[model samples]
Target chain A: MSNPNMKLLYVVLALAILISILAPFLASSDPDGLESAAEKIIGEERFTELEEAEAAIDSPMPDYSIEGKGKLGEIIAICLGTIGILAISFGLGKIIKA
Target chain B: MHIPDSFMPLSQALIYWAIALPFIFMSLRWARRDMDEMKIPILAALSAGIFAIQALNIPIGMGTSGHMVGAALVAIIFGSPFAGVLVLTLVLLVQGIIFADGGITVMGANILNMGVISGSIGYYGFVALRKRNIDIKASAFIGAWLGLFISSIAAAIEMSLAGTFPLVPGIVAMGTFHFVIGIIGEGLITAIAIGAIAKARPDLVDDKAVEASKEVTL
Candidate 1:
């Protein structure tokens, strides 16, 4: 990559990190558009039931938070996920380039 | 929009996966052939940035919130809908496996809605508008908006097909909510991101359509 493009990547990475850290606090607690729509169609209780149904695999970081970690845990979880995605993408890019 | 596993029957999920595999293959081919070394880092940054932005859900009113899906932004930046598919597939995998933000079984449907459909519409829409001599920012905004809105409608249809939601009401609700979300979230964010990236790295953006527009205007 050129110097300018590298600089842009760094800037984007920094911004992404910042957003991940802040998201737990700033992000709305309300249901997202799809969730809200589902709730409207199926009723809130049924929607919740469906969302809570057992899945094939349980995620280590379910709902982007660690159990009993509160908001701080959420911040950590999301930030880690963000950084992990960066590393994964970078690695994938390198492998593809090679 | 991320559809949970329970919202889709196993059979329906399998069908979506079948439909999405070809697109995934094509995206991989594009990644190998079209994405050069210089663009790879940009792609990495974009994927990370998209994942981060998706974590933040800003309220769009009416008791709902939304985030940028980033499919349009990816397509427009890389100048290919395949790029959107590649990036979104990776992001969705991580989200499903680690964060559990989206479901594993229903992932195919999510990918189809947010990646293939949104990416195609967003890229083609922007190119179409730019070909008509429209401003870049305006084209991006409209394209992103249309991509998101239509994708949400598609999701509604999928949900209906899965028997999780009644058809017309599901469409009405999802359509209404995403229309508003598309305007305030996807459209604004895509336009801003495109503008910033173009300003910072003009050579990195695919501006052939812009050039074509200039030719037409001249």
Candidate 2:
């Protein structure tokens, strides 16, 4: 069994992950708060003013999570991130003496 | 924002990947000490704190909230070598998984740009500023701002290199959006967070974390 503290931390973090995952489904499609203000001042053209946003830097996946690869991708990302973190932490514990 | 695959040319992205390889090698090689398992709590808390802070939308005109990425604050709290990058990694993961703030495919590049660039560079910058005996809060504010500002440029360059944007327009576009991003959110948050850390957890900080105030005599 995981240490109680570790379990608690994991539970909290996991809940956050769940909420974050559901965010797109639940969140408003309205202009993000700041964007709304900027739109009021500069009009829709304002966001368009950025040269790259007009050109190529506007990646279609700009903010979209690549929701495909089904559940596999999401599960894999969490595992990889968790593993990466665990490895880094282990290495740091050895090195920095933190 | 994470620069997506669509943003980078294969050639330039490969170049960054190459650069990243040796850098990570050296960073891992250079490590000399160890941290504690308990410290993970610190990292998790710090990461969650950053997420919450970033969640607060500071209204910057033009339809966007410039969120604060706490690279600089984490650096100060954890020191550069070990704790710094870890915080960045956690923050990026949360952003990627939860908010879709960045795409998973481009996560490596985002880590390089946000975590590696700003977290590490900002750490050193705070040190340099402290050498002048600058107030720790001001030191943090400037370092955080500079870290985010320069990293924005680095992201722009990387994006341009990858052919994310047309040459002239890409850099210009990245610079304009991030310059504002740095000023309104990054600077203020850096100041506030650093101040809070200094006050609440002085024990967590390393003495040498911030650089000396003045040049020393041999």
User: Model 2, A9: alpha-carbon shift in Å?
Assistant: 8.7
Which candidate tops lDDT? 1
Candidate 1 clash pair list: none
Candidate 1: deviation at residue B115, Å? 0.6
User: Which of the numbered candidates is closest to the native, going by highest DockQ?
Assistant: 1
For residues B1-218, what per-residue lDDT tens digits would candidate 1 score against the true structure?
A: 79989999999999999999999999989988988777877888999899999999989889999999999899988889999999999999999999898899889999999999998899999999988878888999999999999999999899889999899999999999899989988999999988887787777779776677788788
lDDT by residue (A4-92, candidate 1, tens digit) is: 56777889999999999999999998899889988888998999899889986889999899999999999999888888888888888
User: Chain B, candidate 1: TM?
Assistant: 0.96
Any runs in candidate 1 off by more than 4 Å, and if so which? A1-3, B209-218
Roughly what TM-score does model 2 have, to 2 decimal places? 0.66
Question: Candidate 2: lDDT over CA atoms?
Answer: 0.57
User: How much is B72 displaced in model 2, in angstroms?
Assistant: 1.6
Candidate 2 residue lDDT tens string, B109-197: 77777777877777788777786678888877787878887877787666556543445555565566667777767777777766765
Reference-based lDDT, residue B138, model 2? 82
Model 1, residue B50: what's the lDDT? 94
Residue B79 of candidate 2: its Cα lDDT? 68
